[model samples]
Target chain A: MADAPAAERAATGRAAAAPSRPRRLGRRILGGAGRVAAALPAALVLLFLAAPMAVLAISSLNATASLAFPPSSLSLRWYAEVLGSQEWAVSLRLSGLLVLLVVATTAALGTLAAYAVARGDFPGRRAVAGFALSPLMVPEIIIALSLLYYFQGLGLVNTIAGLWLAHSVVALPFVVRTVMVSAQNLDPTLERAAASLGAGRLRVFWTVTLPLLRPGILAGAVFAAVTSLGEVAVTALVSGANTTTVPVRIFSAVQFELDPSVAAISTLLMLASVLVMVVVDRFTHLSEAL
Target chain B: MTSPDPLRPAPAPAAGPAAHVVIEELAAGYEGTRVLDVPELTIRRGEFLSILGPSGCGKTTLLNALAGFVRPSRGRISVDGADVTDVPPHRRGLGLVFQNYALFPHLTVAGNVAYGLKVRRVERAERRERVAEALRLVGLEGYADRRPRQLSGGQQQRVAVARALATRPAVLLLDEPLSNLDAKLRREMRVELRELQQRLGITMVFVTHDQEEALSLSDRIAVLNGGRVEQLDTPERVYRAPASRFVAEFVGAANILDGVADGGGVLRIGDTVLRTGLPGPERGRPAVLALRPERVRLHTAAAEPASADAGSGGAASGVLGYRAFVGDAWHSEVHLAGGATLSARTHAEPPPLGSEVTARWSAEDVIDLTTAPAEEAR
Candidate 1:
């Protein structure tokens, strides 16, 4: 009986010292369950966003003549056809030119407008800021319809300039919002300090304020470029026969034929967007820019 | 005084000496609300002047007005006899150090220091030399390649000072430059800044809310209150012989005792009468006395009567209510017989709480002000 009590006491001592075993096991199980629950939604979102691009890429390489899932054979015939087409090449060049113009114009106008809104304190400053940012609130179709009517009145329809103008209007708000946030986060004292150190007003702005706003400018420019590259609605409304951008071309192609050529073009557009995003992420922190 | 002779070559432009900065009747406001009203202030060359005041006291406004950041409504600001009131901040030939250091974060320390010279269109070689010299003066010789964020707070402030000094402006304005530093670093930087100012022999105006900082660093301190200069004098004179009750109380903690002058070179506090150095008024006139805590001595009941001839001594004693163990001293609050409280700071450890102690101060140590009362002084 003495040995039995001693053995029970020893067991109790072991249990007391190792009390965290059950708690740790419970915590591990709960943590694993939580991880699974969190990952399931993320996995579902990723598949939802990525499945279309995956299917497009796969269809572009199929040897068959029609759209098919799990192709029996893979081939690059559609890519070769896409690369060899004069219309596709012209549309690609047009889109590139539009992207360049839109990105440059939007970045410049957005940075200037953001500076005025964030730093300047003139009368009706708030109202002016609201008007400048109103593009984001309006529906793109309304913007396209208005631009269509306005350009038609101006006799600028079917020209690249009209398309560029419409795209710039749509892309300007993104640049303005991004750069404005960046300008707002900057320290105003730095400019004042530069001025106090014998720097003229222009020099102070250029040397101090502009350098700090570079990240915002880069972020806004990249977003504007990507958006302008893939813009369809406004481009379709204003673009003439000779000024059809890639998205307009793709839209026309889809109406006539649902083939591997469209998938190839889409895959190329997606690749370009991912490339721009990666470059933007490398140069400036996207989170901070947002 | 004789009028100057008009034909004597304009008296050689009064070649005796010149005040580096002369501010006359300066008045400034923000958005139509008056903030600063300094009647006259002249800062001589090579002097360190401190503008000491609490928040909203207009010290910073005064500095800003002098720096041309705030245009005075009615005043003349002259730097080295040249009127700069209408000039812009960049043209005032003055350097300003902000409270946050304001170092440009995107630029390296060398770039920040070289910015002023570049703006002035100085020769590239001379600019490089001056930048290096300025960095060396601040003891940041090798930190030229580092950005402001990579440096510590003190190092950043030094870079700011270096950047400001690179242009050799006529005056330097430091607005709470050391307020962002820790307490120990603040003390060390105060010494370093004072030494630098003395070595450079440039007129400097330092603004601070800390009395210790102002007293320790300034050649002359302007104590401001309610948008007016309360008193401007040396630290010793300001402390020992404050012109008003506000100056006395603001510069250091004072024990304000209200009394009535009783026509006999004596002041009456309740039923006890004490001799005063201030001239006695007609009977029943109100007066306020400022007593420093260090001047008030605490003694046991047995020893109180012996010091009666020096000042008023009461047989009644009160309990030592609170005791704090300050290093090298003991600060105790004692409740007196008349329900009034007085603090005593002694070199020796005070008696424990609840012990009876008598508080005594000499008549000469109490400063008398003709102000309304202590509550109205501030």
Candidate 2:
């Protein structure tokens, strides 16, 4: 390990001192081969990730109402149609409002739960943490089926309030996991030092604990917003005719008519997800949030 | 066997320095095993006392209890004659500086120092003045705008101290605040901290496992062993006349010799006899003797010139093992009879290796530790 750098320096010096034509060509070829070898897997992964999005974007631009790629002519007619239709507009507005409510509820509830589970030493602390993260492990189909029966029993079917609650429950685990990471990183001694400096419990929480956990809370809010915006399974089960989200509308549209407007709306949702990610990364490194 | 007399001191007179904090029958533990049990301990006003002990000896636990961070299961803690055992840490009106220098990273240096004053509802004008005063006290005047991460370790330590002092509490508790700094910085900060404590005349309770730090900085050192105070005395007495075997070995290097007391101020080891000057523990009981290396004087056997001076005190004859210069003094190891070894530190040159020499010490310097209970291995 210690001599590898020295060996590399010696090799570089040899190359620099003797830059003959044939040797230089051979070295260039070797370097290009090594670079290609290193980048092949990464390029494949990127291609795999972007293939579906590319097809969706391309099909959304078809002039007619057909979800066909490589259309006879490229035009923004479907984008206009999706934006102008009242049914699609209603779903967009409903999804937007639901995203806002889910972000607010999950951010508040997740941060509180994270602090308690990570820092508190009560009897069932581990169990509470496990329960908070259990949604991430259980299948979304199960959650959707359960919420269907549960909300029906509560007379919450077809209500926007029910969809809001459903989205929050689905998005809460991501927020909790991110905020828990930040809470565990928090220095307990800082709180102790604050208390020793004569700050009461409430004062310490407001002044020290809350400010230190801001990055995690913001990251959690972003996660909640993105998760709620993309959620479909739970929303499908609980949402009614008055509260059909864009994803639900697109799901039904692709099932029967195969509308190009569904492709347009799906492309827009993907764009919104990317935009939220960029903004969140600019504020707090998204890698740290997970 | 009887306990040493000087290890325990009488209660202070009414005219002595007033007691600032009193701990009575205090016993604190975690998970049902008591780690600290102080029957009676008092911190006088404006005195620097160090709770000195090795790790796991409950010194930090004692400091936490005093700072109101750890509640004693049995007994009371009183400050200024008011019972505060049940008081929360924030309401205890005491300052504790953590070893890590737990300055809030989000706050600037000035903001960190002003935290206490702000919590007390001090007005903006006065709060600024106190923050400035504290920064100036720790020689951090121009560092008000810099965040804590920008400061060096020494500077951060000063900020922690300044933050603790800004509140003007009744006492300041420092938990090895200088242990994290480099060696030279630690020494410099030690002197600066002593000067600061003396200048302010505020009572300070310093907790440290470093014996040199405790010796140099404390007015009185409380030597703890196995969750008990073995000896609490001036640094000089604790070093010169350790109260127990644990104190002698822990405080400094000591040549502990096992011998049988003859009850006439004499002890016999192997086939050699020495005058201890201290009262013997029992007539025929085995006794442990503690003698500091610095006190043991090495005399060349050929000289034979110390008859009058060395006749009344402890004496032993041994072959010189080796001698090495240790910057300030020459340290020599003497191999005695019966496979025992003795160490001596002296300024003069020691005899050559394998040469016979007589190690002598004054009778008054001998410490007898036979009565101390056998310390459990922690």
TM-score of each: 0.91, 0.90
* Runs off by more than 4 Å, candidate 1: A1-20, B1-18, B262-282, B305-317, B371-378
In candidate 2, which residue ranges exceed 4 Å CA deviation? Answer: A1-35, A62-74, B1-17, B262-266, B270-283, B302-306, B310-312, B322-324, B349-353, B371-378
Which 10 consecutive positions of candidate 1 chain A have the poorest summed lDDT? Answer: A14-23
Residue B203, candidate 1: how far off, in angstroms?
0.9
Q: After best superposition, candidate 1 residue B291: deviation in angstroms?
A: 1.2
> Candidate 2 on B184-270: residue-level lDDT in tens?
999999999999999999999999999999999987888997788988777877887787888999998898877898887778888
> What are the per-residue Cα lDDT tens digits for candidate 1 across B75-173?
898888888899988888789999999988878899999989999899999998999999999999999999999999999999999999999986899
Cα error of candidate 1 at position B277, Å: 6.4
In angstroms and one decimal each, the interface RMSD of every candidate reads 0.9, 0.6
Q: What are the per-model numbers of colliding residue pairs?
A: 0, 0
